[model samples]
Target: MPSSIPRSAAVSSVVAAALAAGLLAGAGTASAADVRIHDIQGTTRTSPLVGQQVTGVTGIVTGVRTYGSRGFWIQDPQGDDDSATSEGLFVFTSSVPTVAVGDAVRVNGTVTEYVPGGLNSGNQSLTQLSRPTITVQSSGNPVPAPVTIDEESVPDAYAPEGAPAAGGSINGLTLDPETYALDYYESLEGTNVRIGTSRVVGATDPYSELWVTVKPWENRSERGGALYGSYTAQNTGRLQIQSLTPIAQQPFPTANVGDVLADGAEGPLDFNQFGGYTLTARKLGTVVDGGLEREVTEPQHKNELAVATYNVENLDPSDPQEKFDALAKAVVENLSAPDIVALEEIQDDNGAKNDGTVGAEQTLKKFTEAIVAAGGPSYAWRSVDPENNKDGGEPGGNIRQVFLFNPQRVDFIDRPGGDATTATGVVEGAYGRAELTHSPGRIDPANTAWENSRKPLAGEFVFRGRTVFVVANHFGSKGGDESLTSHHQPPNRSSEAKRLLQAQAVNAFVKDVLAVQKQADVIVLGDINDFEFSATTEALTDGGALYPAVKSLPVDERYSYVYQGNSQVLDQILTSPGVHHFEYDSVHINAEFADQNSDHDPQVLRFRP
Candidate 1:
């Protein structure tokens, strides 16, 4: 939330005294200015007259600021009649001009486009008037009526074609105020808007921002949040509420999905880099909690073994001791310290130092030490070091998947002769069942799909009388993919191809083990970096050889990660046909909270082996 300057009438009189004090108020009006607010705002994302000087822009003062470089916002009472252009614009006076809301004023300034992020970012810049000289034409002038936004007004689709050639750039296309979500938001950028009694769709973020849906979400859930679907069908009804009220002045409201905003909110619309369009609230209403509670899963029974997957978000020995402690608590208290836990993003011994330090013995040791200190069962880890710099992640961080198991409950089958370069294959071991040639070895290490990515770690673990093969994976991320509001319709999922290939490789390996033993209990789990309803998951579970355990959880509780306003599942556990009738839980210790230790929530599965 950016700081705002106080709009005191006394201050306005002191700055623009010639008009506000008495003279200009008596005159009542100024001659018609050559340029209007719409001319400076234009229809596109970038201002058409950026860097050009404009004179005599007239509008009523809608908002005034006194903090930082104090300034005020002005909006034309009668706009250009073009639905595409915004009527309001911010006037930066550098604490010079004191303007009160409802004072009609004439401003002269340079038209500028301020990019929130740098130029390289695809984000559109904010159009503003800088170094403005203000003259109050009249005081007590009525401001423009705020446009009301309701469910029927928001469109289902989010954006037009996102590619540059397809009018993806904000400046490239003519916005349709009623058709697409992006268009509707762009049309209202920098204008006064009102949201009638809406529901909180997204949990409040640390910045005091929450997403709300006006009314009648397309796939409305009982929780008052819109259910996530294909990206093409953007959840248009959902709008982000950004509080301009400083935390010290008024605290940002805390809310969860299904919470009701009885009075809704009204604010000046703003566009920023993080979320496309946002409302800087002038009046924020009350929040009624949905009473959503964190779910506690049942503990594993005597004969039952619980296996879990957790992404520690690149944990290293150098990380804060508290982070490790918090993670360990989530595993012990929230996840019940499963018999076997597949850990992702475990860096090498040197942490992030780039000197070819591949062994993670020190890293795993510190984590297990913290777990024990946190009252969790003492755990042992098994992992094959990867060729440094070959696995993708941070430049110096060789992030890989590792297995942590409670030795008292499960035995990790370790075979000799495993190395970073060689691929692991299914082979006959002492038990005469299908087994990894090398426990905790990379599966198809040389596969092109695993190139510069985290290779799957296949390790065999035996609990009681059952043997379960676990494949721990961290797939390629959705890095270069377009945002939800991208110009390209159905924003391209650029990372899907590589993940599909990785999924195929893992599926092939699972098939080999199942071929050796039709009922081989193989568990593949980790941060797949995709949804359960994605093609990547389809590739992994093709032929019904492995089924996603997440699908078994209730739909509303299926999410393990929350991005933007969507509570989506990016981490998943897929089990072989041999493993059935298991209880699963997507532990929600993180993701929904503002002070989450990790970006992802861990999941656990319990069943009789």
Candidate 2:
């Protein structure tokens, strides 16, 4: 049986017996001297005396959580010399205890290794006192002063490279309290600590949890907010804030990046599954928003051609009509019904039926019908279906990229030789510009780099007598990647290398077209699944072959996705040199709201073509 238990449930009989005994300290006090908190919390995540029963554990109650795993944390007034071991411990009472904050209590309980997820879950294990029996020695005792955590307290690096012991995870590594962030947090686990003069780095979640960073980044910090961890500099200061108070009494305030916890959050440090190190805030201060608001792009110019890229998030025929209607509204109302839209994740006719159906004609027709019904112009679309299971996405869905263009605004030039197996190539055409042999064709579909991924769909459109080439892509995802709070300091990004190759393939095709016509209007856009500052983008923009359209916006305004309170850019619209001086808008319709239609926000670029 797994050790993972519901927070509201009771522990095993052994732990229950210990708890019953501890609570029934009855009438007499034990003669045993109070043990220092650090003695029970050794240098590692697990206690040295784990699985053993101990008595006279003394401390002042610092915080009490009444709802789940009804428990309170206690910290010793006089701590030990070893900075590697924490001075605080949680007493799991299973129900609200009679103990009050600032009360000097001596607890008798069994020490155990409580893995938040499970023993095999690779989550950080917390050392806690379970089934505790408490004896309140006195009331009105002063709580120990919280240890202030600032830049000097946390290390620059987050963790060591490999296993602590052979075949073990970095979680079991020996403590380097002053050198690694993981080691430092392990040292202070279950301790009443303080983050003085702190600012919120991430937004507050529905669960009332927020992330903050105490230390400043060595490199020029972006708006004093912590960047996601990297190899060169692991963001060691980032810490999650978990409120212990009930939602009704103390609802967590809504916040954004650069918000201030003016009084500085103070709490007992805890290690949990979702976030590695969290402070169960005993006292939460005021939150000041950094003036971050939902961004709106300027409307399109009548004479200029407007093109947009949107990830429809697996729209298939089998999906509900409301989803299609909502997506059409997003395109018309939010995206302003651009002349041309590059759409990714358009699924097959009978989505996920696993019957080898590959056409998306019904899906396209339904979307167009919805668009017209939503007060938008009727749109025609083009797409090439991939062989079953060859294109990576939702299994059995066969998701692919497609282009939706209004006949009143642009014309999609059609040619021959477009099929699932035949790769599209740049060829000389009648317009004195490079053209695709097939208007809507897969680019290098058979290439190993595109294995199990959506092949880029290249299409040529004539707008105002000028040919504009558009390549719609949906790259391999960042799936199976390690978590940001993983045991590894800067968790490995195994997906980046594959994205680089995809970028290279697309870049080579762009270069081939540009070589023939230096001023070719080429638009490469879709769910790139990478940041603007990443190696994948670098590959796309090498030697100024293409310019990222999002760069036109202010640095603070360049984002299309928000995850874990972080506003970031994963979808982008990059264009060739010919298509310059364009009005670009990263319309913020979805990413920030709970009622989002898609994970990605659509982007539109209006330019003369």
Candidate 3:
């Protein structure tokens, strides 16, 4: 039976017990003549002296964090010769610390290992001194020099192999700071670190944080961001940066992909819940724009049919009018007003108000009207209302896929009798071609693979007297997957199982259409929520039913999303064998920009059938 409290929770409880044992206000004090900062850190992920009280551990204060887990970090100026043990340690004070930088202080506290997001989260534990008692020995002492992080310092190998007998965990393994990048960072955890002028790989987010790469040449994209091509080649140089100075005192720089952090940053290397290893900077760099610009795809020729996919990041009727207008502008200008646009995450009319309302007429109307207002063609839309709360998204939003088409250029073949739970099938048409039994219908809605997930929407369209079958998908997300920085050597991607099944289901439906008519013009496009090289994509392209069109572009320009500093592919447009040549463009209007309307960059495909 599973324990009532998880192992990490139990560990946390022990730390709490230590804090309550008259140590919070420095009641029990011990001698510091035998112990040092590195001694408490040990040479493993967790402290060897964890849960034990130690006093008179002395160091110079290097950095102080006044808010959000208020604490100050101290470093021994004369560190031990072993590179495996860190010289610096964070002292948790639970409130504003009276200490300042350069103050030599002796601390007494319980050594504890704090796991961020719990052990089940697979994150490495941070060695820290909790419930500390501080004695300022002297003032005006120089803080320890910061270790510089660069290409040479970070190893190409991401992590060391876990101990097999220990259920593939690296927690108990000795630190190899010289061999692996993860171990190298772990050895310097809570230590003063510095990076020279570096290129920004991730755009500054709402939380005043960004990512930069110390290795400028490792898997570098054409736009100055890191490209995540495969699972094995995790870019180990990416380090998240956060300012230690209060935002009120100095505003954090706003940066985009390819921007430069000119003078670089220096501060303590800390680990936290969001990004594993971070440089909480006491001295920050200035932002120099790299001149990266948004891309615009050429409008489709008169004889070509253009189809596009865009995830509007859970658009709703209650969203700000400016957001609606900006998205409309992106659709018209950046996307070049494609003949058919498959939009994902279109919320219901009431937008997150849970009252069993699943209709999106108001939501679609406002969007289509905004497009017209933005100087685009008047568009008609079609979508099946999902069962209330069945689709996985924000609670009460009932987000679903929608197809918007310009009736003047293309026609939506609307077949009656399609509902939320009904599954659509491929059938022989009057002209001996393949057609959907129910136009604007859900595909395999009852499949267990689609449980609590968005079902694919299948629609039949006619462009210039040629019939085309289009399937729009928004597969299960990678929500529960572990981060790349997990202590587990190869981070677990538990979400891919459901996505693989989803892909196989969509692939089976496309194969059915090909079975009826060998020359069926089928196109599958949407936010797949998986990488192009993932097993999910292989399943979707199984037996050659469809070909991912994103592969046709240059390797560096293939991504439609920027995630955690890695430019990657999540949205894709795939075409069947019957559809031969096409032009594909992944418009970069949103993902890489600091100010954006959506989290995804829309993709467009133009072809003559």
Rank ordering of all candidates by TM-score, starting from the highest: 3, 1, 2
On the 0 to 100 scale, the lDDT of residue 452 in model 3 is 97
Angstrom error of the Cα, residue 45, model 3: value is 1.2
Each prediction's whole-model lDDT (CA) = 0.78, 0.78, 0.89
Model 1 lDDT tens row, 492-556: 67789999999999999999998888888999999999999899999999887899998997776
Clashes within 3 Å, all models in order: 10, 2, 0
Q: Candidate 3: misplaced stretches above 4 Å?
A: 1-11, 14-33
State every prediction's TM-score relative to the real structure. 0.84, 0.76, 0.95
| Residue-level lDDT tens digits of model 2 in 218-326 | 3312444454322354467778887878788978777666667777788888777667688888887787666644445566776789999999988998889999999
Model 2 residue 364 lDDT score: 94
Worst 10-residue stretch by lDDT in candidate 3? Answer: 1-10
TM-score of 3: 0.95
lDDT over C-alpha atoms for residue 491 of model 1: 56
Quality of model 2 by C-alpha lDDT: 0.78
Residue 36 of model 2, lDDT score:
64
Judging by lDDT against the true structure, name the best candidate.
3
